[model samples]
Target chain A: MSVVSLRGVTKRYGDTRAVDDVSFDLHENRIHGLLGRNGAGKSTAMRMLTGQEVPTSGQVRVFGENPYENADVLSRVCFIKESQRYPDIFVARHALEAAAMVFPNWDQDFADRLVEEFRLPLKSRVRKLSRGQLSSVGVIIGLAARAPVTLFDEPYLGLDAVARQAFYDHLIADYAEHPRTIVLSTHLIDEVADIIEHVTVIDRGRIVMDDSSENLRSQAVTVSGPTKAVEQFSDGHEVLHREDLGGFTRVLVSGVPTGRDTASLQVEPVSLQQLVVRTTQFHDAALAGSGNGNGKGNGKGAWS
Target chain B: MDDARPLFQQIAEQIEDSIIDGSLPEESRAPSTNELAAFHRINPATAANGINQLVADGLLYKKRGVGMFVPAGAREKLVERRQEAFGRSYIAPLLAEARRLEMDAEDVKKMIDAWRDDQ
Candidate 1:
């Protein structure tokens, strides 16, 4: 079932089009990844989904109905941001209490367990919490809300390696018990790539790629061989990315290699992060080569 | 949870999942390192390391001539092992944290009830 859907949605900021005519369906009880480079309109798209930002055009639906100012839908959705802000006087317990009251399906026991697991200081005010602790607080609330649809926007800013691993473990363990729609938007693509079932990649205010994580990983492979053989094999194939390493050429192609008589060829599946970075970079180069397309080339060069 | 354990330990649970789901039936040949590596986009060495860990634990055995196969009675053993580890790994800390938070047994039950009511 589609828990969230966007059809021809566009969000504009004065002269800037933050999100342009984007459309996708997020299914229920699956973890989805929303990925993009900075300023790529990922955040804008997420905001529109949560009704935090009004769409300039087209439709946005959550749970099969328009979510704009709809308390019933909004109440069942929890958006955990990178930097969660609370009132200066609000203590950790106060926030937890407020969450318990606000979320109709709040799991206080789970919340309290998470508080202890994260080692949250209940008496400490929100402003005094460290960046890692703040992220933890947001994660605790999002998980404890038990909302049908939960969106986490870059919730691991200052978390150390240990803390981040803890977050992943707890998320998987809890998710096994209670399946829900989890949309994780993060730049640490490699970290959550394994847990996500599907992914949507946005670049330059448009949806460049959206597919199952399994297919995305499997559909592309990097083949490295003699430059001549590589070029010959790559002919008529959709090359998502390519790299020249000394005398050898490595090309990431979208599709399995078959019927090749070349003896000196090696092919391997590309990592999810590698695939996304290479794909977005490839698109950028194509756009730049066209010269008239979305022409805001920074010239620092794309993903050297 | 320490970083010392290989990152694939976190993913090895998936192989266990295959066993539970009958994807890799009892005594059936397990996936090869290259297959797993390609399927997961992981380093072949890391994939082998995960398989080796399971091999060391006796959940899987090598046939030498034919690759690896799930050990007989592996599923039952895994269940027993997981149930045993669940006590110290999950329940103990949970109860300790609850007691430390001043939540008595009755309070814990009440909290569960309130959560049910809210849902």
Candidate 2:
């Protein structure tokens, strides 16, 4: 079941269309990676879903209700962003205490436990905390809130590697006990690739790819060897990318070959990060080509 | 450790690895899917899929409301399967790589002899 969904959602900031005609479901009880490059409309799309931003044209649904100004939906949804601000006078506990009041399922004990683990100084004013510490405050609230629909938009900005791992560990562990719909946005694609069950890749305000991570993981592969052999192996496959180095040819294919007759070619699976990069690169090339210069290689160059 | 196989398959193999190595004894409780997921930094569903595959293979059995466990005689059955699969998994790949490097039968024989002597 879909706990949250967007239908042809378009969020335009005056002349700039941040998100355009995007549609996908945030399936219930699964971790989703809302991934893309900077300024790729990820944050804008997230804002609309969380009721923080109104779409210029389209529908945003949370629990079968419009999320905008709907307390019923907003109470169950928690949107944590990296640049989240707290008043200068508010201390670390003040912020978390405020969150506890909002999320009905909030656990103060868990909040307190996470604060200690994250090494956040409870006494420090929110405005005076270091970047990493500031990030911890948001992570603590997001995790402890136990909201049914939680969206983390690059939730960790200045957090160190250790803290990030801690967050991930707690997230999966906590999620197992209490299943919910989670949409996490991040540029560190490889780290969350395995943790996320589904992936929705947005590029230039468009839903370019939305599918189970398993499909992406199992289908995408890199076959490299002698030019003819690689080409023969990758024939009739959706080749996402190809490269030439002297006599060798390497292609990223979206199909696995039948009967491991992979004698000459080395078949390697493409990592999630590689898949996302190649896809965005392909999408960009098609757009730029079609948007300029006779549109000669627009479609042909995209999948070549 | 770095293999191109899917995450769930790799996870299933890792559990099988422990079983084959005598680390996870017979009839012992298998780690919960959540435990494995957190440890590997993977989705719990993937870990569950891996465990479920093992359960389907009779290498593991589910106990009601408790957890998955290695069945009695699971180790022996797993060992037999591993032994049968060794040639395809290890020797075939070894020979393929050797052939790629243009190694003749004599060169392979020498390398095997040296490897056995070292062992």
Candidate 3:
């Protein structure tokens, strides 16, 4: 069942619609990847969902009830972002203590273990910590909070590759034992491609793609061969991207028929990152072709 | 881990490879979904889906409160099925590449003989 649902949600700031008529569901005990480029309104949508920012129009529902100013709903939700702020005098330990008090499911032992694993300095002031150390503080709180509905928005801002891998390992290990609804919003799509069960791609305040990761994995393929043969094979499919080099042509096409004969063409699978990029570009091109001019104008150059 | 197919299918194939290679013998307990997920660093739901596919195919069976187990003849059955698919999976590509190089079946047969002598 869907634990959280947004219906026609629109968050506007001044003249800009940060999140435009967005509607999607977060199912129970599943990991959802919210992905998009910078300035694509991913943060705005996340803020509205966490009740930090209310939508100008439409509804934001968590656990079937409005999350705005609802302590009961808020307690069950944990929003961790890269820009999380603490008091000037607060130390790392104090932050953990504060989180332990706020979250009913907090585990002090888990938090302590994470503190050691990340090599966090508990006595140091929160502002004095290094960038990676600061990110680890948020990561520890987010993990040990164990909220039923946890949302992580770009939680690995300054973390090194090793630290990020450690975080993913810990997350998978802990989540296997304690399942909960998780929304991970990040630009590192390939890193979490296997970890996430569902994917939602947002672009310019609109959702361009939303589906289970498994379904999206097989949705597109890249066919490269002689221009005529490649074009003929991808004739009926939705071409998301195309590149030409002399007589050779390559196209990324979606909705390809399974088991189609491709004896002359080189067929390869499209990675999740490539799929998201191509889908966004395809959406942008469609908008620009319609004379809307609302897109970022990057789409018009992709066709060449 | 391959990008060419769904992750769950890859997980299932990994388990199948273990079973076929005698590492995971028939009648032995199979890895739990959590074990697979933690080992592969993938979502538990995806690992569970992989296990469910094997169960649906009758290669693995549940012991009800115990855990999943490879059936008695799972290895043999898997080997037979893989052999059936060898033509499409391996030989077809081999022939396709040979055709591209302007080589006939007789040439491929001679090349295979030469490769065997080298081995």
Candidate 4:
């Protein structure tokens, strides 16, 4: 069942609609990847969902109730962002203590273990920690809080490769034992592609793609061959992208028929990252072609 | 693991490979969904989906409160299924590449004989 649902949610700031008419559902006990480019309104949608920001229009519901100022719903939700702030005089340990008090499902032992694993300096002032160290503080709290609905926004900022791997490993291990609804918003699609069961791609101020990861995986393919052969293979399919090199042509097409004669063409599956990028570009090109005319016509040139 | 197919499909293939190689013998317990998820560092639901695929295919059976087990003759059955798919999965691509290089079936047969001699 969907634990968090947004219906036609629109968060506007001044003249800008940060999240425009967005609607999606977050199912219970599933990991969701909320992905997009920078300033795609991911953060704004997340803020509205966590009750930190109110939508100018539409509704945001958590556990079937409005999350705004609702302590019961808010308590079950944990929102971890890269820009999380703490008091000036507070130390690292103080943050954990505060989280432990606020979250009913907090596990001090798990937090302590994470503190050691991340090599966090508990006694150091919050402002004194390194960038990676600060991110670790948030990661630890998010993990140990064990909230029923947790949203992580760019939680790996400044974390090294090894540290990020440790975070993923810990997340998978802990989540296998304790399942909960998780929304991970990050630009590192390849890293979290396997861990996320569902994918939601937001662009500008709207959702461009939302589906299970498995369905998205097989939704598109890249066919490369001689120009005529590639064009024939891509016939009647939704071509998200196309590239030409002399006589060779390559196209990323969706809804390709199975068991077709691919003897003369090179067919390869499009990666999740590639699919998101192409889909966003395709959407942008459509918008430009339809006279939205922002004059940012970079993606439009590729179509012709 | 690769982007060529779904992760769960790859997970099922990995387990099938193990069973076919006799490493995961018939009648032996299969890895739990949690164990597979942790080992592969994937979502538990994806791992569960992979296990369910095997269950649906009758390659693995649940023992009700115990765990999944590879049924008797699962290895032979898997081997036969894989062999049936070998031509499309392996030879089709091989022939396509050969055709691109302007090689006929006779040339491919000669190359195969040479490769066998080298092995």
Candidate 5:
């Protein structure tokens, strides 16, 4: 059964529809990657899921109940975003302490360990911390909260490679001991490619793709060879991206290679990040061609 | 191993290599998926998938809630599978390269003898 479900969930701000008619389910004990380009509505969707924002015209359910202002359901969910705000007087440890007060399953020892790993200052005011330090605070809480459902929206804003790796390590370790639903919204698809079992790619306030990572990994492949062979193979499938170099052509297409003879073309699997970028680009073009595309242009680049 | 192959498949192959090489002997506890994930910096779920595939292949078995372990005869089974794969993965390419170099089977046999002696 789904622990969280969104049906036609739409959130609007003035004339802009940040999340438009989006719907998906976060299953129990599953790690789902909520992926998309900047301003592609990933954050909005997450906020909606965490009940920070209400859907304008659809249903959003958490534990069979609305999450917005629903303390019973909200208590079981943790939403950690990069831009998380703390009180003016609050320090790094203070934030964790406050979260511990609310979360029933908070593990103080785990929090303390994570605090050391992330090199977070215990007594430093939240606002005085470095960018990476601020990110660490959020990550520390998200992991230590042990919420039944946790949503992390680009929570590793300024963390270094080592710090990011430490987060992934701690996550996998803690998760093994205690199974829970984890939805990580990130642009670093390749980094987390092996981590996510399920993937959901959103673009321009719409869900472009959703499937098991295994299925997605096998379905899309980049084929390169003689121009004619590549074109012939790509003709019927949905081509995500294509590049040409003189007589050689490479096309990224979504479909299984089925034939008695496919020896002429060299096919390779597309990385999750590549697939998402290409797919969102294709979605972008389609939206542009349709002339009334709900382009958020929220300025969140894939890398950022 | 090809990096293009799925991450879980690569992980499974690594564990299989360990088993076939006698490092992970029969009846010994294999590392948990989370342990492998942390060590390799991959997702624990993907590591779990790879281990689960081994379980399905009969090379590994679960000790209830204890952990996954190599079942008896797993090494022999893997050796049999590897030998079956040898002809296609190694021999075929070797023969093709020999043919391109204009070396007959007898000539290749002599070369193998020379290589063995030098080694």
Candidate 6:
């Protein structure tokens, strides 16, 4: 079932169109990675999806209905953002209490355990909490709430590697027990590549790529070897990227080709991060070459 | 043992400890990915990386679409493999360094004896 659907969604700000005619359907019971570079209209699209911001044109359907100002839709959707504002007087526990009241499926026991695990000072004011602790608070609520549709917009921005790993662990564990539609929007693609089931790449306020993570990883290969040998092997292949390192050359090719003599070449699948970078690079070049310096890469619908 | 070993290596050691302590017997189902991830609040990718290492070492196996379970004789296999790795990756390096530092084999033998006696 489609948990969310967007049809010709366009968001404009004066002369700049943020999201332009982006159409897609997010299925239920899967984790989706909302990937994009800075100012890709990801946050804007998310705001529209959660009903925080209205679209200039097009329709957004959450569970087959409009989510804007809809109490039923709002309650079922949890948007955990990088900057979550709470009352100045609200303490760490107070925030948890507020979250508990908002989420019908809130588990107090799990929240208590998470608070202790994160070592958050419950008595400290929300504003006084460290950036890591603040992020932790949001993560704890997001996981414990177990909302059917959870959107996390760079929730671990300021967290260190260890703390980030902890969040990933908690998310995986909680998610295994309770599977839901999760949209994780962040630049840390390689970090969470394994857990994201579906992926959506947005660039210039448009959806460029949307597919299963498994297929994305398996479809692209990084071929590297001697410069001449690599070039020869990459012939007739869709090269997403190419770089020369002295006598050696590396190319990220789309889809592995069979019947290719690769015994002398080093061929391996591209990592999720590499794939994203190469894809964005390819888009940038195509944009520059089209003489539409002002164009947002074909004005959306770039994902083919 | 280096105190600052990688997190995944540390996790692997912890799982080994559970086997040594009889907490997780051979052929038992290991903790699910979610259990490890949620309990550690780790990125599921990192936790999976650690578990994949264990799986590579024959300590764990997946049951098709089901969760991972401990392989038969996994405890014994891990114990043997880890003992070999310790000798090569740690003990050999320590002995080599000790030799370079002018510590005699007899001295090393004496130190080992003393450590064992103390234990």
Candidate lDDT scores, in order, read: 0.81, 0.87, 0.90, 0.91, 0.87, 0.81
Worst 10 residues of 1 chain A by lDDT: A295-304
How good is model 3 by TM-score? 0.95
In model 4, chain B matches the true chain B with a TM-score of 0.95
- What are the C-alpha RMSDs, in order, of all predicted structures? 18.9, 3.7, 2.2, 2.7, 2.6, 9.6
Best of the candidates, TM-score: 3
| Docking band of candidate 1 | incorrect
* TM-score between candidate 1 and the true structure: 0.73
- Tens-digit per-residue lDDT, B39-78, candidate 3: 9989999999999999999999999999999999999999
Say which candidate scores most in lDDT: 4
Better of 3 and 6 by DockQ: 3
Best-fitting candidate, scored by DockQ: 3
- Cα lDDT tens digits, model 2, A1-304, are 9988899999887777788889999999999999987777899998888888899999999999999899988999999998898888999989998999999999988998999899999989998999999999999999999999999989888999999999999999999888898989998888898889999998778888899988888778899999999888888887888999999999998878777568877888788888987887777777886783222233333321
Q: Taking the tens digit of each residue's C-alpha lDDT, what string does model 2 give over B1-119?
A: 23577788888888998988889988888998989988888889989999989999999998999999998888899889989999999988888889899997779989999999999
Instruction: Please estimate how well model 6 matches the true structure, expressed as its whole-model Cα lDDT.
Output: 0.81
**Fnat (0 to 1) per candidate:** 0.00, 0.63, 0.89, 0.89, 0.58, 0.32
Residues A1-304, model 5: lDDT tens digits: 7999999988888888878899899999888999987787889888887888888899999999998888999899999988999998998879999999989999999998988888899899999999999999999999999999999989888999999988888888888789899999987887888778899988878899999887888878889998999988888898877899999999999886677245577888788888888888777777776776764442323444
The regions of model 4 sitting more than 4 angstroms off are: A258-260, A293-304, B91-118
lDDT of 6 by residue, B6-72 (tens): 4456667788789867899877778766667566554454466678988888788888877788777
Candidate 4 is graded, for docking, as medium
lDDT of 5: 0.87
**Residues A134-215, model 3: lDDT tens digits:** 9999899989999999999899988999999989999998889889999999988889999999999988789999999999
